[model samples]
Target: MDFGVTPHDGLPLPPRVTICEVGPRDGLQNESAVLPVAVKAEFVERLVDAGHTVVETTSFVHPKWVPQLADAEDLFRAITLAPGVRYPVLVPNSRGLERALDLGVRDIAVFGSVTETFSRRNLGRTVGESLEMFAPVVARAREAGIGVRGYLSMCFGDPWEGEVPVPRVLDVATRMRALGCTEISLGDTIGVATPGRVAAVLDALIASGIPVDSLAVHFHDTYGQALANTLTAVRKGVTLVDASAGGLGGCPFAGSATGNLATEDLLWQLHGLGIETGVDLRKMVDTSTWLAGHLGRPSPSRTVTALAGTS
Candidate 1:
């Protein structure tokens, strides 16, 4: 319980970090067992109860492609939106954005790939075509006075095409930023990023005139380097992080990808370092454990398992 630690000299870590909980949307969509709408609603509410300010509620992709989140509208209808909590949904295109807008959603995100292969596999379009698809969505969202987030997957590496070139990643990121994306989340979709690579990518972005405050990091734990990569990003001045509760969810399109960095585990590390996130570690662990039970499995988060005493 005592997370006190002596200060390290000149640590560039931010004093506070904002955790964007993606369990309800990103986490549940990849799940094989489709949970009831009420349960998913409860999961989002519980995350809010645990002091998460931003929770990705669901995606508006076609039900045929992602059946797990087909109940997106139903889930929104079933849940009570807490005041001051930002619930963003994923919108794959113009229609997806329309669906989100119909539900009175204030924030929406568009997913893109930095590589041509992943763009074709995931979005069914090439990288250039996907960017063209997002341009209108981002423009309309901004015109509607809605906040738009751009999710660039495979920022570190890709499964089909191997390690993606840094220039290609930067080009897509710059394009997204030009499209009026208020915030951009860099995704380690395959969990192949190390601390050095993380730093290099972030530094490149910074050099390209991307503000650190406008950037967020989303890392996976496939190679057990997510925490280290996240820490490196945080120290490089990124405050926003995307994580799934219980370390749930992987890229369905990328077979080699693994679960995201767990909210509980990220919280444990951030809180231990005396960085404020406003999230209750105990409540987050409890939320993860509760959701794990519904998923018929134990939590994948080390912190959750240790805190909840679930083997």
Candidate 2:
């Protein structure tokens, strides 16, 4: 199904923007307190009912590294799977893919980095090596009739290298797509991207003849630029976007990276612009609110607080 990102005249926005929420996986990955499996399942269900069609459910990695997601299998099993909604989980390697397949998951995501430093630190491999590692996994996934999405981290900026050039990101993106990835998500892992730079990168790709449909945007709001950056992408004819509810996830490798853009905030902005996200702003807010109450804190989504403040 085409995520409705058709171009509209004179407007700096797409006709449709599909938000693939990663709060359940990316948002919760770094938290010290482990949420109960039941709580997480309930949260995802409410989100789906609220109109999130694509949810990043969990990561299939070693528990030793990310202890918070140890119950990945349990969480995947417990969630009452919805028919129309698609749930994609991050699988670090073949072992992760096996785990996902064991549960009969329909979609899976693989990740790699454009920078050598990021690749080494995050996955203990070089950028080229990481792609090589995912080659078979991607191939097998396609053969199994499951969908694959590739996350290209540090596409715009790198923590150690700094100011990643567009050419480097392009190379990785091409390789990932060739590996059978359905959507190549360019991630501003540290949220250092600005609107101009985001457009420049996307434009560069278009010049390279990569269709925008198979692309998604993932931004971190560290400098409060994720929304603006996302809007810029929308204007450029890109459709699929990745966001987290309540700005839950932050990049563990990059200092001061912040979390992904808040789902509620993005919805608020998109709705105002007359671009449909098919997400119920109130239900999204409520799910995050429920989680926040259990965690004993307020949400990080400024839009959620500003608009729903009276409630």
User: Highest TM-score: which candidate?
Assistant: 1
lDDT of 1 by residue, 226-285 (tens): 999998999899999999999999988888888999998998888888899999988888
Q: What is the number of backbone collisions in each predicted candidate, taken in the order shown? A: 0, 2
The Cα error of candidate 1 at residue 178, in Å, is 0.3
lDDT per residue (tens digit) for residues 1-311 in model 2: 12234445666666688999999999998676799999889988988999999999999989988888999999999999999989999999998999999999999999899999989999999988999999989998999999999999998888789899988888888888888899989999999999989998999888887889988999999898999999899888888999988888897767768888999888877887778889988888888888888667788899667655545
How much is the lDDT of residue 187 in candidate 2? 96
Candidate 2 lDDT score relative to the true structure? 0.88
TM-score per candidate: 0.98, 0.95
